[model samples]
Target chain A: MTVIALDVGGTSMKAALVPAPAEPGAGGEDVLASESWPTDRTDPVGGILDFAAHMAARAKALGRPARAAGIAIPGIVDEASGTAVHAANLNWRDVPMLHLAEERLGIPVAVGHDVRTGGLAEAVLGAGRDAGDFVFVAIGTGIAAALILGGGTYPGVSGWSGEVGHIVVRPGGEDCACGNRGCLETYASAASIARRYTALAAVPAGHSTPNGSVNVRAEDVIARAGTDETAARVWSEALDCLADSLAATTLLLDPGLFVLGGGLAQAGPALLEPLEARLAERLLFRPAPPLAVTRLGDRAAVHGAAILASRLL
Target chain B: MTVIALDVGGTSMKAALVPAPAEPGAGGEDVLASESWPTDRTDPVGGILDFAAHMAARAKALGRPARAAGIAIPGIVDEASGTAVHAANLNWRDVPMLHLAEERLGIPVAVGHDVRTGGLAEAVLGAGRDAGDFVFVAIGTGIAAALILGGGTYPGVSGWSGEVGHIVVRPGGEDCACGNRGCLETYASAASIARRYTALAAVPAGHSTPNGSVNVRAEDVIARAGTDETAARVWSEALDCLADSLAATTLLLDPGLFVLGGGLAQAGPALLEPLEARLAERLLFRPAPPLAVTRLGDRAAVHGAAILASRLL
Candidate 1:
């Protein structure tokens, strides 16, 4: 089966022509032709549809003859209804994305939350293969998660499920973009850590470190862990916050495995080792599950979209 | 067809002979026989077996020829393995509950977590009949929850799921019996509310009320909400904490309804109304599900056990 897959991101959109059954591991051979495009968020809805049409057209030009297309977007999406309910970053609400794409591309379209689509990919063809129950937590600019249970990605009834980022971790420690105080995202997310380190660098000498001295991004802070005291402190606190939230999730869900994804997961052992140790400490009697970085990396959503599209075909 | 149902609690045990195909929404009728006994915590493993034997003897004496037995118990129980993994309150670990019951009763036995079994009763026969996805949250001395998805209770992989009370809501607020700081149980449980109120009463002149001196239990706190400022403050905070956790749950697993049970749920509209409003505020764009009190009250677990027993028969 051949299908067109489009993964919409904040800065870029990836499009792919994939053939199934996709290979069952990282760096597999099932993926055929793939390409990328810069995403323009000026007119987010138009940008999304145009990108989908462009991907479909490219596949057609290549004689792939794609029967269906899948688009994965970042935000709350109602997969059952084929609607993008809300995307704060994209400034979209209630966009009938599937219907629009179907009309323009003249093919069946499967619309899904980006993280859920990525999780679907992992569950079916990557790290979570053969696992009946698992949580796919993607840590990017902000944190979110997808739950795969009994062979499907469970989109909570309201299409707002898997927003693990907003779970309160500190209660009253820091204000979040969500208007809540001390949400998990305010501490553990890449964006949050960067913001925290930047703020700390601004403090006057003899007191706390000044935010101006840091001028470091999330990756820069992560790189300085061994040499920079400030970076190590910020990173340590971030890990602690994440471990706290994951422990809470473990207590409630008792998932067999946790597949970590998104940009921050590239830190690999730096992120996993301490997280595993801390989760073990916090859990009362439940055994902690194995935690691993997603095998698909940045392409997970596109791969997952391909899987969904193939199913439609 | 008739079967035996046993509900084991920390302090007492209740057993009933239930007719098969139990009536919907009401406690089953034609209870051929019923018995009660004190739950002996010392040597809890032996006590559980003894309790099952007593119920079996009573059933046999009634001459109903009960065909199967269902038992429900608190704590982390592995229903599939018929073992009570851990019950901190009961001080039992890996108790082979099913084998003991089967040996004593000489009948097929079904075992399950108490709250989850109660949720099964509601999902199949009570207030949750219409909800495809819902959570059954029972707030007693400690709080726990059961997830009902796709017409069944999700026991999770390790059978240690649904420990919702341990989800960190206060982060670093109060010490929990689980040795964690600021678990949700520290603020929203029936025990916590009473404790908070008692702490307020211990304060000196600063605690004196405009109307009169006040001392309140959890039940009294509910009653004094309209007139007493202290009671209202504590009650409202409890409601807020509950809403925060429920909102997080919704974000992760968007259930269609929340069925509240146990002692605290007796507060009814006072709890439901505020919880609904607060949850709505936390939700970004999705619609909030209806919140209702469980119709079965304290008897839900026993009824659920009866349903499971009937299935076995």
Candidate 2:
């Protein structure tokens, strides 16, 4: 069976014609065709519909016409209604994605939360495959987690289950974009790390590398942590915040494992080792769950979208 | 059909001969016989087994013999194995509760975690019946929560979920019995509130109630909060810690409701009103779930145990 999978993010979209597994509960898949494009910020919904139509056309051209389509989008998604309730980055609110996609592509459509879709891929076929219950935490521009229990993402009361970023690790410490104080994201997100490092470095009290700019990325700050005092402080605080939140998660959920993904997870050992140690330190009783880097990387969401589409079929 | 249900705590036990629901998915139950006793701290397992046997005998005498039994126990429980992994207060370790109960009562047995069991009762037949996904938080000697999703308790990977007391709300604030600093339980648990108030009042600070002793209870501290400055401060800190933990829970789980139970919950409006306000204040973006007192009160666990026994039948 063939399906159209689209992972629509703030800046880019991963569109694919995926040959879904022929048998039930199958593991592997073959991508029939794939492409990427910058998200049309001004006409986001139109862009998504056009992309689905294009993917359907491509699938037909390959003589493997798509049976269903799946689109993984960011924000507060009402999956039951197939509506993108809100996506701050995309300036989207209540876009009837499933209806629009079905109208355009002439196939059953499934819409999923982006992070949760990524987590679905990880839970079924990636790092969390062996971990019975796990949390897939994506640390990109912002932090979010997907609780995968019994091999599926747990959408809490609403679709807002894993808003781990807003968990107050350091109450009344730092101002967050969410209008909260000292959220985990304020210290640990990729954007926050770079922003914090730059702000700290720009201050006159810094001893070395005082020249700060918005161009500085989390990777740069992580790389400079070895000697630069400001970078070290920022990175350390980020690790602490992440540890605090993860510790709370461990206490509440007690998942079998924690799978870290997204831009910051690229640090690999540098991120995992200290995080493991800090989480252990924070937890006085019970062994800490093992931490692992994402196995599927950025392609997770697209694959998960394919899985969602396959489920519809 | 009838079942034997027992809720064994550190200090007390609630035992009952409960009639199994006449129909599946029934709302109410009739207690054929009910009784309570001080827990046999020296021989907790023996006490539990004996209690089950007595309950079974009583059911038989009443011409409604119990076909199954359920025991709700504190501390770590391996429900799958029917073993009480460890109950600190009971000094129990790997006691084969189900096996012992079955041998003693000659019936199928079900073992469950105390807090989770209470949450089950709330989810199916009590306060959380209307709330789809809610966290049942019991703030007695210590704080713990049960995440009820789809009208059942969500047991994490190893059944060690809902250890919310250990969540660090104040990073370096107060020392907890779990050997952690700034845990939510340090400020919010019933025992902690009294302990904190006593400790704060003991020091030679200017206050009306400077004479501190172990005799003071959480209720006394809460009652005095209106007049006593130290009591007010202690109560405020407790509320703050609870609010912080609840905020994190809201972000992580986004439950439909929060069902508060145990000793502290007895404070009623004084606790609920301020807690609701603090939780609202802490959350910047999303709306906080409504907080309600447990309708089953102290009987939630016993009722839940009955539910478990009915499942066995």
Candidate 3:
């Protein structure tokens, strides 16, 4: 059997045609075909339909027609109902994702929340493969987490679990887009870190420290944190907020391991060392879980989508 | 076969003999014998051994030979190792409870953490019996929660998953015993509520609202919340903090039901009504999980110990 997987993001979609596992307990299927498309932004649903149809056609031409497909997308998704409740960035709501995909491609389609799909992938094949229970946190433009239990995603009753970014780590510190004050995302997200750093330090015109930034990126700030005073303060604050949030996450779930994904994790030891120290110090009694960087990187969700599609077989 | 159950606490110990089910898939085990003894604060370990010996003898005298036993205690416990890691109130550390109990009682003894056991009871037979994926929080002197996953306790890798009390509801608000500021316990636990109210309110010359206290108890403060200004402020603050913590809990775990246990839950609607309201108000997009009061009350842990003993069968 063949399956098609699509990871729909805010800017683009990564779609792949992967053959289902040949045997019940075998290794992964080889990617029979794959493609990437810029999301319509104005008409994401239509773009998804067109791309999926094209993938199905390509799979058929390659003599490996996909029997089913799975999609992972941003925003509130009702996986059980296969509906996209809302996608603020896409300006879409109540788009029956499963129906539209199945109708367009003539195959069963599974829809899942993006972070959760990434979490599932990590739990089964990435950083948390050996860990019993773990929280997979992605800290990029935003910070969110997926609680992986028994080697699968434990999406909440209302399917709103893992909104760690919105949790009030700072209480009344700063205004959050969610109408809250001092949320973890407001202080710790890569975007927030860059924004805060930009507000504090003026980037020199000749500044060049690897990954060039138009202004000053989170990476640029973190790179200069060792020597620059302003960068040090901003970077330290972000780490403190992240450590504080992780502390709360530990207290609530007591996950065996915390798998840090997304762009911020690229800082590697710089992020992990301080975070590990803060979490261990804060959690005085029990041992803090090991924090690891994601191995699958950005492709984690796409692989997870294929895994989800394979389950449909 | 018969099994002994013991719930060791800071103030007292509740012990009982739970008979093995006569037939498979039965409702519950019959209580063959029961007893309670005031715990010796100075010699908690000795008190526990004496109480367990007495309970085992009582069970044997009643024509029921005990084959196994289960003990629950207040502290940082490693259930797998049968070790009570730490109990500050009891001034104990690294006590190999399982080994000592088996040596003295001549039976297989299962040692479980007190709050986790209470959460087990609530999940299997009390307020949380019907709720799916619930969190059982005991709000006495300090607040702690247990994640009841798949009808069992989700003890973390190091057996310390449910320390929700330490989650900072207000950063830098009040110093917590765990060396943190603005922990959930500092604002929402029964002890905290009463302490804060005492500092803020003047009790009436003649005031009695069940659970009696000379100055003011949590119950008294809650009882006067509707009429007294100071009581109202304190009560509201506590509820708000609780609401905030629960919101974070909901976001992280997405529990179907929240089983509120411990002393303050005795306030019933006074606590639940405001909490439910606040949680619902704060969670604008998602529906709030129903918060229910624990039915077994103080006996919840003892019953859980009995249940654990039965599992030994």
Fnat values, candidates in order: 0.76, 0.89, 0.75
Residue B143, candidate 3: alpha-carbon lDDT = 87
Ranking of candidates on lDDT, top first: 2, 3, 1
Please give the range of 10 consecutive residues that has the lowest summed lDDT in model 3 chain A.
A21-30
For model 2, the superposed segments whose C-alpha errors exceed 4 Å read A22-29, A203-214, B22-28, B203-214
Docking class of 3: medium
Compared to the true structure, candidate 2 yields what TM-score? 0.95
Candidate 1 lDDT over residue span B1-313, tens digit each: 6788888853588878887756564445446777777787677667767877776676678776778888899888889878888887898878888988888778899998999998988887778987889999999888989999888899989887778888878766789988888888999898889788767755433355545645445887788889877778988989988997887778778789999998998989989998999999877556777899998787788888898887774
CA displacement after TM-score superposition, residue A144 of candidate 3 (Å): 1.2
Candidate 1 lDDT at A102 equals 90
Docking class of 1: medium
In the predicted model 3, the residue pairs found to clash are: none
Highest TM-score: give the candidate number: 2
lDDT of 3 at B236: 91
* Candidate order by decreasing TM-score: 2, 1, 3
Give the winner by lDDT.
2
User: What is the per-residue lDDT of model 3 for residues A1-313, given as tens digits with 9 covering 90 to 100?
Assistant: 7888899963579988877852224555357777889988777889899998998889889888889898998878889999998876788888899998988888888999998998888877778887898999999888889889877788887678898888877766888887777888998899888888776676554464334656677898899898988889989989888888888888888788899998899999999998899888877766788899998788778878888988888
